[model samples]
Structure formats: structure tokens, C-alpha cells
Target chain A: MNELVANLGVSYGDVLLELSYLLAAVFFVVGLKFQSHPLTARKGNLWAAAGMFLAMLTTLFLHKDADGNGIALTNGIIIVFSIAVAGVLGAVIARRVKMTAMPELVSFFNATGGGASALVALIEFSNPNNSSTLVTLLGLVIGSVAFSGSLIAYGKLDGKVGDIFAKWTTYLNLFLLGIVITIIVFILAGNISYDSQKLLVYGLLVISLIYGVMFVMPIGGADMPVVISLLNSFTGIAAAMGGFIYHNQAMILGGILVGAAGTILTILMCNAMNRSLFNVIIGAFGGGGAAATHEQGTIKEISLSDASILLSYSQKVVIIPGYGLAVAQAQHICHELDTLLEEKGVEVKYAIHPVAGRMPGHMNVLLAEADVPYEKLIEMDDINPSLPNTDVVVVIGANDVVNPAAHDDPSSPIYGMPIINAHEAKNIIVMKRGMGKGYAGIENFLFFNDKTRMLFGHAKESLQKLVNEIKTL
Target chain B: MEQAFEFFYANKDAIFIIVLSVFLGIEVISNVPSVLHTPLMSGANAISGVIIIGGIILVGHADVSKVSVNLILGILAVLFGTLNVVGGFVVTDRMLEMFKKKK
Candidate 1:
């Protein structure tokens, strides 16, 4: 079938190929537009998939030479088999990855992206005709870093890796990066022998992999969202480098889109954490959120029934969700409580910190899964002003986001971070497993505030109890 | 195997688009509301999977010298690019599908 199609396609292959690729790019744009809203997201994805399929098909059947011959039989077979297997694996992973593990899964995907782009650069460099040494090196180095960095990110998120990077690790990382640059400059200057160039490529790949791992090791957990975004952008830029090597328009455009978006995301997340892009890259903010010297504080407990009453009669209530919410899978019951309160003529809203949860947008996705209205899910800036007027604030599974030290204590690691003003509310109800510190590893001064009341238990169980008690009220 | 300068000269327009699109992408995706950030990231990454086309073209280019190194690298590129495109779009779809607007 493919042979027949290729034979027929050879007649007007350029037009067919270019037109199909153009259509696919259009679909990608439309699909992205669709993804912005709940109503159109699924269909948008389908459109994008259709685009990818069409692009793949054109390359497979219509790509031909001056003599009208097709791709090498062995190469064609290998491509088909690999795609078939990858499609199956992708489908399985898409189905199997839990909501809580999305961040790690994303990192895993990013690793593949980075690794793949680097491979393309390697092959292009090997081809004597493709002598774009600069472009190849950019793709090779950035892609390798993204690959290894993402793996470490996955390990960190999954808790399989621990932070052991010390102050000297930074100096070593800089030194290694200097070495990578020196090798690239030599190759670009054509100072290396042809035989040794290949060896240098291998050496470069290894050093980049080490650099990537060292990068994330000492960075605080509070800055993970930023690191993840930065690495994601690296993958995009790397793809563009490969595209430059291949002179492929679609790859270039697609890479540019992702690289740009990821850059913006990294910036926004860094701003949310009150850190500069420079600070994040230098990674001097070490400790991985390890425990700090904590101040003593008195704990005040609130009864389930009292919590229900306080929530039931409140004029306005805001729920601040953190990683613990997703960790305990409390989003569903939390939404149930949201509705239960809203049904009683109490206004309810969700205050979402950008860096909340395990990854970017983690709480929003979980809450949206629970059928929370988009309007009720508010950003920190939009929600903080109303926080002072909120009659009751229910903080579920969240910690550093609501910690007042971000604003009040300059000595705190996360001192300058923007947080929800949960403490400003007339009543504050904190649902936690214990008095455990948040990811920032600092005592939540809000926990010791006069208005704060701790309702301790698993987030899911506690929210369920709140639902049950609210029904009685 | 055109040298770097010739390749740049020929695809100046393409390079220009790449640089321009970087800014455009950032502006368009600036505020994707946190709820959609993950899906959008996945979606954006899916777009990068267009590198699959590059992989396919590189290995399958009619002018490609069937050197063993080129063949092996091409195969690896195909595998990685396919995995990225397939996994990225599927995961993004799965994430988007899970969003149920409040009743």
C-alpha cells in the first residue's frame, strides 16, 4: 500500500507534502486555541493529532527524490515499527499516570524530547555535508542537559533522589560548563581533527548529562516549578536547533512556540516564588527545603462541628489548596464541600497559588477534575484582595503558600514569595495531617496566628468529615 | 551537506520566523490560567514533536548517503520523536478530558 501511494504521490509530491504540513500547522494553532477552554479542549487535541498524523503520512509516502524513488526500505521499516511501539507506550502511560504524578511524567516526556533532539544533532554532525557546527552544538548541549535535568527532576518529584549538592558543587558545575563551551569553540573554530570530533561529541554529551544532574540537586523544592519550566524551554530550543540542521520549517516553528511558552511560564512561576531567573539558574538558594531553625508556637485545635458551623454561616469562604490536597486526593471531596457551602448561599472560591501543588497548575487541574467552576478558581493576585473580606478561609493540604513569613519575615527562605492572605480572613481553618512543615521547610506562622485553627487528619478524610458535618449543620 | 553560512542564507526567512514565533508564543501563552498550564505545556511540547518530520526527512532524504551512522541515528531520532509526539498529545488530551466544569 505504501509503495503504491509513494508511486502515485511522486507526481505532485512537493505540493502535497507542503500543503499537508501547512494544514497540520494550522491545526496545531487551532488546537491550542481550543485547549484554552474546557468546552473545546478535547476536540482541539483531536485536531492537533490529526495534524500530526497527516504530517507523518506525508513524510512517509510522499517524500521522494529526483528519480522518484522512496525512502530506504530498511529505514522505512524501522521508522514504522518504532512509531507503532511508541504509540502504544504513549497511550498506556497516558492512561496509567495518576493525576498526582503528572509533573514527574512531564519531566519524563521532556527527557525523551531532549534526548531525541540531541541524537538528531549527532547524526547531522556526522553527515559531512551538514556542517552547521554551531547549530549542532547548541542542540547537543541543551538537549543533553534537558534530558539529564528532567530525569533528576523526575527523581526529585518522585522522592527517589535526595539533595546532596554543596556550595562547591556550584563551582564544579560552572567549571564543567566552561569546559563544554571550550570544546564547542574549538570545534567551531575547526581546530579538532575529524576523528577526534566524534570523540569530543561523546565527551560533550557526558559532561552535559552531569551538568544537568548537578543543576537541580541543590535547588530548593520551592523552585521546582521554575526549574521544570526552564528545562522544558531548553527542550524546545534544542528542537529548533535540530530543525535548523535539517532546514525543516515545521520543526522550527513548533520549537519556537514551545520555547517561547516555556520561557514565559518559567518567568511567571519564578515571580510567584519571588525569585529571579538568575537566582534560579545560579541555584545558590540551596538546601532543598530542608528543615530550618523553627520558632516555637502554640497550636489551637478546632472541632469538626465548629468548623462546619463557621463555614456554613460564612458570607464568603476561600479554599487554599496545596500539594497535600493532591497528595491525599482530596480535590473531589473538597469540591463537594465547595458545592455544599455554595448551596447554602455562602460564596465559595478557590485561591490557587501559581506554585501550589507538585507542579504548575496542579491544584487547578485537580479542582477542575472535581467540577469546580472556572470563575471560582482564582489566581493569587485576584483573590488576595478579597481575602481580607472573606468570612472564613479553609486551607486544605497547603503550607508555604499561606505562610505569612513570605511577607513578614525576611529571614525565611521563601520570605519574598507571594502567598494567599489566608491569615487576613476573619476565621482560618487549617486541615493538615500533622504539624509538618510545607515543602519550603519552614514553620507556617499562620499556623500560630490567633485566628488559625488546626483540624488535623488526612486531607481526603478531613474533607469528607467536613462534608458530612456540613450536611448536619 | 551545505555549510552553515549557505544554509543560513537560504533559510533566512525560516530563521526569522523562528525568532519571531518565540516572542509570539510567549505573548499568546502568557496567562494560560494555572488550571490549564500542565495541558498547555504538554500541548506546546506536542508541537515540538514536529521534530519527527525532521527525523523522517533526515533519514529518508533521497540524497541521504546510506552510511551506517546516518541510518542508526535516523532510527533513534524516529523513535524519540514519535514517542514525544504520541505521548505529548495523548497526555495533554487525557488531562484536558478530565476537566469537568462545575454542574
Candidate 2:
């Protein structure tokens, strides 16, 4: 096979490799374009996977170093075996992960990619023939930061980690960041002796890892989506550095694309909450301060039968869902109620707050799993105008998004944050396990409004009872 | 310092590709609806797995004579990169599969 390939000319093999990489790049672009719409999203994923397969196959078979040596047989076996085992492990974990756990899973995957890139940089830096120290250092530092940072994000999302939430953490983070930059500059200045280069590189790696941890330590849980997005961008840039190291167009394009996607998401999440990225990074929001001390008003309870009757008689009803709905795993039952209400001549729609649930568009995915109609899921801005005309607004396992304090209570932490106008509707019925405070631990002033009626129960049970009552009516 | 400039001069094409890709990426992804955010993110995450190609190249050239640093790191890189690629795509497909129009 080697003799045949040499007979075919080394330049021909290089041409084949480059052409395959170009084709893979095209596939990625088309796949990303297709992902913008729901109907083609799954097909888009397959297309991108095909591209990945082609790139990996071509690299494994045709890759040649500057001396024209193909991969040794033993090394090839190692590569194939590692890929096969890791691929199976990855596919199994992804298939088994619950939809509610998707955010953390994404974080975990991002960390792996970052780790791979960082390792690549580490190996290259130790190579005798390495030329681009700057690119290698960058890939090493950025990839290390992304890897450790994402793991912390995963731990936080899994409820295994707690926020530090101290004033000094911010200054500490900044100080560490300054040190990282200073070290990078010092190494690049070339004043350090060659004997200490290895030590400096390892030191940079350690400091970057520490910086990554501190960077994420103080951020509250509510800002996780943004942090995840930002770290994802870091991984992408780090991968691009690998591309720069090897002069690989596929890696370059792929890295930039992911970097852009993560940036867009980060900005979108920030806009959804009416908060700046700086504010989110500084960890000043969603800390659950003294907002709960003020007495609001008397609470009114509503019976299941009355709730059913209210739904049955309403001309139009809007459902506001939150992380609570996800926790109770009530999305399917919630959908059942929506279907039942629609059959009773009541128009039903779901109002989705951008920051609702745990991640960006988290509630939509949950409802989609329950097979809710796509058209019925209205965005917060679009649904707010129609809310005043809505006859009934049912708040299910949700609080802060509809708390009204976001709009009226300037003293509230969530004051300027956008919320679904569930308070504006004629009648409000809130389903909850109890009068417990929301994830942010802020008091929901909507509960005290005259139009509001509390229906206390686990979300799934309450939704089931409401469905049954409506059926009987 | 001279070496840095030489590096840029040698890889100008790669730099151009990076710049153009950034704009194209922003353009293609800007209009994705909120409903598809999770899937879109996961899909992009999978694409970052393109680093797997780098891992393969490294592993292919590694000195495998008795557990060298190159061989170990190369194998680990391939493993992690493959995991990111396969897991990211599979999970994304799972999410998108749930997003069917009401039947």
C-alpha cells in the first residue's frame, strides 16, 4: 500500500487530503445553515456528523509529515482504538442523558474538547521542531481555562457545587487574570532563559487552570447559561489555535463557527435578562438578598373544581412555565391540560420567558418533549401584548418570570429584568408545591395581587387533577 | 519576534479562512429561533470536535516505543476529541427529534 501510494505521488495524496478538508468545511456551513430552522435541524446534525467522519477518515489515511512519512502501524492502531472506545462511550452517555440534564451534558462535552486542544498544544510545545511558540502558548492557556471552567459549570449545574458569593472573589479573579496576562507577555518577551522554558509553560498552565476556577466560582446559578456560552467560545478559539498550529482549514473554520455561535448565545441570554455580560460575570445578580422581609398581603387559595371551571369558562388562557414545571416533571400533564382546555372552546397558548427554566429556551425543549404544538409556544415579548386580553393566565411551577416585582419594585434584585405579564391578565391561578420562594429566593409579589389565586400541590398532580376536573365538566 | 512574523507569513491563508468563517458563522446563526437554542449550541459544540483531526495527526506521528509522553497525550487527545464529537452530535439530534410539529 505504501509503494502504491508513493507511486501515486506524495503531492496527489496532499491534494486528496486538502480536497476532503474543503468538502468537510462546506458540509459544516450547510449544516449550520440548516440548524436555524426546526424542520431541518436533525438533518443538519447528520450532515455535520458526516463532515466529521470524512475529515477524521481522510486525516487517518492520508496525513503525511514534512518528511513524507505516513502514520506508523502501531500508532495508527492506538489512534483507532482510542477513537472507537471514546466514540461508543460518548454516544451511550449522550443517548442516556435526560433532557433536563442537557445543559450540564453540553458543558461536560465542551470541557472534553477543550482538554483535547490543550493536550495538543502541550505535545507540540515539547516537540523539538516546534516553531510557533505564541500560538502553542495561546492554545495551551485558553484550552486549559475552558476545560477547568466548564467542569466547574457542570458541577454547579448538577447541584454538587455551591457559589462562594463573597466580595473579594471579584478582585481575586481580576488579580489572577492580570497575572496570567503578565506571564504570557513575559514569556513572549524572550528574556527567560531556554532552561526555564518548560517550567514557565507548566506554570502558565497551572495559573490558567486556577484563573478558570476563580472566574466561575462567584457566578450565581442564574448566570450559568451565559457562563457556559462564554466558555464554549473559549474552547472554540483554543481549537482554532490548534488549527493555526497545523495549518488546517477545517479546524480553523469549525473553531470560528463555534466561537460565533457561543457568542451569539451569550449575548442573547444577557439580553433576555436585561443584564449586561459584565454584571453576570461579576456575580451581582440572583443572590436572594433581603427582598423577602417585606410583608406583601393575604394569600387566597382556589379549589381544583373552581380552577377547572375558570379554565372551562375562559375565552383565552395563557400558561407560564418555569424551572418548577421541569422539577415536577409535569410537562406532559401540562400539555394534557392545554389540550383539554382547547377542546372546551378555550384558546390556549404557552408564554415562554427567554430566561425561564435553567437554560436558554429550556422550557421550550421540555414542552416540545411533551409534544406541544410549536405555534402555541409564544415568546415573552410577543405574548405580553396579548396577555391583557387573555381571560385566564395559569402560572405553573413558575414564579420569578411572572413576579411583577421585576417591573414595579425598584428595590427588587430582578427589578429591571423582563417578565411574562401574567399579572396583567384578568384572572391568575398559580400552581405550586407550596408558597415556597422561587429559585432566586425572591418573594413573588404577584401572589399578593387581588386577581391571583394560589393552587397548592405538586405540579404534576395538580395538572392531572385539573385535567380530570375539566373532563368531568 | 522574527519567527512570529515568519509564522504569520507562512500561514496567511489559514488566517484569511478564520476571518471569513467568523462572519459566515455569525450570519448563518443569527436568525435561529429561541426554540432551537439548545440544539444549535450542542451542534456547534460537536463541530468544535474538529480538533479530533489534530489529535489523529499527532497520534499518527507519536513515538510509541514504551509509553512516551507523546504517545500518551496523543491517545488521550484522540479520546476526548472523539467523545466531544460523538456526544455533542447525538445529544443534539435527540433534542431536535423532540421538536416535531404537533401531529
Number of the predicted model whose DockQ against the real structure is largest: 2
| Residues A1-473, model 1: lDDT tens digits | 56776776645676678788778767777777677666777787788788889988888888764456677777677678878988788778877988778888877888888888888887777777675778899899998998899889888888888776577988998899999998898787787688898898889989999999988888765566678788888898898888787666666767777788888878877777787898876764533342345555789999999999999999999999988888888888898998899899999999998878877777777777777887788999899998889899989888888988788776778887888989999999999999877766667889988899999999999889889999987
Taking all chains together, each candidate's TM-score versus the true structure is 0.88, 0.93
As a TM-score, model 2 comes out at: 0.93
lDDT score, residue A400, model 1? 84
lDDT for residue A135 in candidate 1, whole number 0-100: 86
RMSD of each: 4.5, 3.1
| Candidate 2 RMSD to the correct structure | 3.1
What does the lDDT read for residue A39 in candidate 2? 87
Listed for every candidate in order, the interface RMSD values in angstroms are 2.3, 1.1
The most accurate candidate by lDDT is: 2
lDDT of 1 at B77: 79
Error of 2 at A106 (Å): 0.6
Candidate 2 chain A, poorest ten consecutive residues by summed lDDT = A284-293
| Fnat (0 to 1) per candidate | 0.66, 0.86
